[model samples]
Target: MHPAAQQAISTLLAEGKTPSVATVKAKLTEPLPMPVIIAALASYKNNPEAITHTAQQSQPAPAKPQSQLDRIEAKLDKLLALLEEKQ
Candidate 1:
């Protein structure tokens, strides 16, 4: 299982939220592999308390280095440069 997926499950359990495969899938920013999700779900099922315990030990996620706007602007600039080069 991906670390992020494990962390998400851990956090959800800690928050007193009951997570399903669908709910965990919905919470992720990127698509995680099916096997990873299944494994995570199985881990939760086998040991619910483990997830909550790990959540308490884990550190908070770090802030993103670039915001959405910054990424969009960079992509637009590259596109404009390509267009200008073609002319």
Candidate 2:
């Protein structure tokens, strides 16, 4: 079972809600195969502890710096619009 699926199920359980395909799928950050989700649900039913494992902490992605080319492109676009307006 995918770790994300397990975490979703665990979260649902913690929230006092039963985990279903729709609910589990909705809780996932990324999409998983239907069969994989189904199998994970079944596995959870068989052993709830499997889904109760500690969730791993994920770090947020760093912000990307704006490139010089992007700034130049924006300036060119503005210049083009102004030129078009005067035409």
Best by TM-score: 1
Q: What is the per-residue lDDT of model 2 for residues 7-86, given as tens digits with 9 covering 90 to 100?
A: 67877888999999999998875569999899999998898765555443432254564455777899999999999999
What would the per-residue lDDT of candidate 1 be over residues 1-87, giving only the tens digit for each residue? 577687767656667888888878766655698788889899889988777677667766787755557878999999999999999
lDDT of 1: 0.77
Question: How displaced is residue 78 in candidate 2, in Å?
Answer: 23
| Model 2 weakest 10-residue run by lDDT | 53-62
* Model 2 whole-model lDDT (C-alpha atoms): 0.79
Clashing pairs in 2: none
* Residue clash pairs of candidate 1: none
Estimate the TM-score for candidate 1: 0.62
